[model samples]
Target: MNFLADLLDLILPEHCAGCGLAPVLLCDACALPLQGPARPARTAPEGLPPPWTVTTYEGPLRAILAAYKEHGRTALAAPLGEALATAVKAALTPHHLPTTREAHRGHDPPSLVWVPSRRLATRRRGHDALRGLVDVAAQRLRTTGVPVICVDALRQRGRVADQAALTARERTTNLAGALDVTSPTQIAGRPVVLVDDVVTTGASLAEAARSLRKAGADLLGTATIAATPRHHPA
Candidate 1:
């Protein structure tokens, strides 16, 4: 199934993933919104740096993400991943003594860890969506000379109901204690940024953060491609 999906990605996809306008995977105009000066997320809980996002999870961005995640439009990973790369860079800039990657060379570069999806979800989709995006995001950063490490450090412990219909409080409860670090050695004492595809109520990021901190990660902040509209305000 995965092989067939990859084959289809190359042969199919005649329209832009974001706007469906034509001949390219993503048109520049549609990619504009993903380019952001990442801002503090409105839903950030106390004690964690706000997860910075590039755009609101709506319109073209939403469509593109859905296509890539749920529908197997794997080709869309390039643009979305690059957008995630931008968000990651922005999220770390302010905290560094100097803004450029060159300046941070002396110290160990931060690790980018993503929220792990459930095994059931991965099986249903035949793909681990967010992990693919994070891999690309890290690659995009590396091509531009950023020193970084991408780690698949978190793992889900047990089943939880689908988050699609959950309210903010319910989401928090459902995900509480649902994730754990697979290897503390990979994250311990290192500055880390949590990555995700979207931020709805921030329940996932908060839970991920909790596990990473417990494992001894510095927990620089969180970064995502987009966030719910209410969290992305004007």
Candidate 2:
């Protein structure tokens, strides 16, 4: 299947999502923003884990993500996933070295838990966009010897309204109690990093963290490809 996909790519080369350059999913100029010095998100919700992002959700980066996520441009996953891997690395670097040493002593590395999109949204889109991104990111991390594992431990428990027009508080209210851990055992005692494609109001990630912690997961932090450029009150 992977070979077939590669063959198709060769037969019908794709243009960069950020720019119209052919033969690449994303060009170097557009990818620069994604290769970033990740920092804690400015608009993180209360009680949410420290959130890190590669870039602000705007410009070519925003357009590329929206295309990949909303328009079925799955080919963009390759470059976007690589960018996500970089963000994850930046988030984990300070503690990853010590964790690596512990792994040599037989301790398992941290587990990655992707915060899935709402069920209705996935159904509407006919695919779980976040899952594909998570898979690709995990694969990239493993290739670099990160000693990480991807775990699908979260699911939505109720419907959430479209958040695009919702205020920050409304977004939080809408997501409250909407997410739950599906397998507590898989997450129990594991150092977990929550993954998402984008962070806007931070409501969804905060709700997810609450559920994981309730299930006994050691929530380390969160990582995202991009974040909205709003000045969140500290």
lDDT of 1 at 234: 65
Q: Could you tell me the lDDT of residue 218 within candidate 2?
A: 86
Assess each prediction's global lDDT (C-alpha) against the native.
0.84, 0.81
Quote each prediction's TM-score: 0.87, 0.85
Give the number of the best model, judged by lDDT: 1
TM-score result, candidate 2: 0.85
Tens-place lDDT per residue, model 2, 1-234, is 245644664577687778757557778898888776778778787788668887888888877887677666887888778778877877777674434456679886878899878777788666888888888888898777787788999988877798899998998899889999998999998888898988988888898999999999988888998888875499
Which ten-residue region of model 2 has the weakest summed lDDT?
1-10
